[model samples]
Target: MRFTLFISAILLLGCTPKDTIAIERQLILSADFSHYDNFFPIQTLNLIKKGIKDKIHIMYVCFDPGIDGEKEFPGEDYMDDFSFKIMKDGKYQPTFDKSALVIGNDFKEYFKEDFDSYKKLKAEGNISRFIEMPEKPEWWQYDQTPKNSKGKPMTFICQIDMGRIIINDDCRLFVFYDQDDRMVKYVYQRT
Candidate 1:
């Protein structure tokens, strides 16, 4: 009887579930632009006209915030801190245009407020607004292509629009999204 009781107790303990904790994963950013062949060719010329003379650096960086993996984070709004560079001759040249880069959350939010006007401007192909980029990424507008830890495309949360060139007058304008497509990374120099 004692042996049976001990065996039963061991079985009960073994049957109990073990406590486990969900491991959080770090976000990953990948630079890939092979998907936008059409926009680059034409936009490259426009960039040159704006004084960018070298091959435009196209980077696709996707951040995967592991906890809520299903959310889609747009890279255009995720640029908190970044470095801009230009390729001069045969080398990568760091740019001093850092001061020129501005974060425009208010402008974006304001623009978003007028959905009808925004749509109209977008339809007219004049949606580019020269404003500061958002200081922090807007998680609420998490609309982008989802990627796995390995940097592989998993699923798309929302349809990406074409890249838009927000002209900074004669100085420079960074292309956030073209048509309906978002770029992971973009770098150029102001001439």
Candidate 2:
């Protein structure tokens, strides 16, 4: 299983867009899953990036790793929900035809100011990105990953939490990816 997973990872990396590979290579993830939490950790973000970007489609994952009644073990990497919606006519509207509500951006304009891009991170005069590994120790690869939009390849980029009051608690991660920037800007919500 590990070998299959590793080969899949290699192929996935080989398939990613060149530009998405050059994004925020360095980031600090702080999850509320811990106690006495004061955002103070410099762990690398590439592990999560490589795992999801390579294996899964360049899209968003509304994931919460510690949701109750699901995982048999705490801190186990589990993604059972990928719900997504849009704000149309000043009210939340569903844009999905299925359970996986994938929201994708064009090849360019990933860092644009509009909410169409998850870079809507700059609120309250600040920008924040969060990612944290479960006590599971590693995120090798995802099973049953999603497919890209418009039958085009995409690259996973960054993550955003719409409900950011506290991370890894009740917040569903907003993972984004793209097919522009030479590839797609993909984000997988791994909270």
Candidate 3:
């Protein structure tokens, strides 16, 4: 009877619900482009450029502009989500249709002064030429390794697209490559 009770108690203890802790192992950078000189760093840009050169896939995450305050937009089933794209045969191909992911109005308003230039570039389709140029190291701030929510040290690479004036402050796109250098994750932060 004692042996059976002990075994039963052991089994019960083993079956007890385990405390689960969520740990974020991935590195994340919170970049505020408005103060580009302070947050954007040079080394990170170089790393990202290298990743792009290596043909790593890019993932873009953004909130649905039509949605408001955590409320789902009519006919929308999923929250603002990540969009993955890959370069195949020198062409960028998105995994899903991205007709809904338009630039936010706030960004357009904030960059109103540069709107005409941006429009011209868009019409010319020569935006890549500007981004492909070698970035001046002096233009960026220093690299910063900050602790994430999980207390893990992460490389935080932040950049502001001053030239493009494309995205709003609430919307952020993070670009990084995996160990294989075959995948680039572009995480968009929606306020």
All models: lDDT?
Answer: 0.26, 0.29, 0.32
Question: RMSD per prediction, one decimal?
Answer: 23.1, 15.6, 21.0
| Poorest lDDT segment (10 consecutive residues) of candidate 1 | 20-29
Alpha-carbon error at 170 in model 2, in Å? 4.6
* Tens-place lDDT digits, model 1, residues 30-127: 12222311111111111333232332332212211222222222333223212223322312222222222222444444233333333454456423
**Can you tell me which runs of candidate 3 are displaced by over 4 Å?**
1-53, 56-64, 67-81, 99-117, 120-158, 161-164, 167-170, 179-181
Error of 2 at 98 (Å): 13
Off by over 4 Å in 2: 1-94, 97-123, 129-144, 149-153, 160-164, 167-174, 178-191
The candidate that achieves the highest lDDT relative to the unseen native structure: 3
Candidate 1 at 90: error in angstroms?
6.4
Backbone Cα, N, C clashes tallied per candidate: 21, 16, 0
10 residues in a row with least lDDT, candidate 3: 16-25
Better of 2 and 3 by TM-score: 3
